[model samples]
Target: MRIDCPHCGLRSNEEFTIKGEVPKARPDAEAGQDAYVDYVYIDKNTRGRNVEHWHHSGGCRAWLVVERNTITHEIYSVIDVQEAQ
Candidate 1:
């Protein structure tokens, strides 16, 4: 697998570290323990297209947003996390 880091050009997947799926929103601090527990421990693990956080640890060391097919491992797009916002 390969990832096209916007700042470092194309690189091997080994250069990156998977940081898991991006959360829709973070739970509020006052939302209580159950809410926090669910947010921290639960895994949605949905199949199909998913957006994830990847760190270019072996390259530019930048955080990226990777949009890819979970089942096929087909990367649709890779962009710097800041640019993604």
Candidate 2:
């Protein structure tokens, strides 16, 4: 599959690395161990229309927000992270 990077044009998926789901929250220094463990090691494993970050390692080296369908491997949208905000 190809990911269309705004800075580099359409590129193969290999050029990018999956950076996992977006970090919703960071455990505070005073947070309990279970909270920290969940933050560090858990994966939501959601299906369909998942939001994620991808790094374009082979081209402009920019980050992008990818809206993809996990079950079908179909990407719905690709936006530069900065522009996305």
Candidate 3:
């Protein structure tokens, strides 16, 4: 697998680090038990094209937006998360 890093250019996927999903805002700490439950267990382990956060640990140390097909282990795109939006 390969990923294109904005700072370091194209490189092997091994050069990056998986940082899990780029989550939305978290519920308030004082919102109670449900908030804690959701925070700990809510995650979308999607099988098709999905957006995930990754870091180029072995390259430029920049965070990347990885568009991957989880089931086939095929990566469609890799771009800097900051520049993606």
Best by lDDT: 1
Error of 2 at 33 (Å): 1.8
Query: Against the unseen true structure, what C-alpha lDDT does each candidate score?
Result: 0.90, 0.88, 0.82
Error of 1 at 62 (Å): 0.5
Question: Which model, 1 or 2, shows the larger TM-score?
Answer: 1
For candidate 2, lDDT tens digit of each residue in 1-85? 8998988888899999999776668988999999988998997978987989999987888989998988887988899999987
lDDT of 1 by residue, 1-85 (tens): 8899999998999999999988767788799998988888887887999999999999889999999999998999999999988
Residue 54 shift from truth in candidate 2, angstroms = 0.7
Q: Write the per-residue lDDT of candidate 3 for residues 2-85, one digit (tens) a residue.
A: 777778877888888998877756888788998778777887877788889999899788888888888786888777888877
In model 3, the worst 10-residue window by lDDT is 20-29
- The Cα RMSD in angstroms, rounded to one decimal, for candidate 3 relative to the true structure is 2.2
Better of 1 and 3 by TM-score: 1
Error of 1 at 53 (Å): 0.4
Model 2 quality (TM-score)? 0.82
Top candidate (TM-score): 1
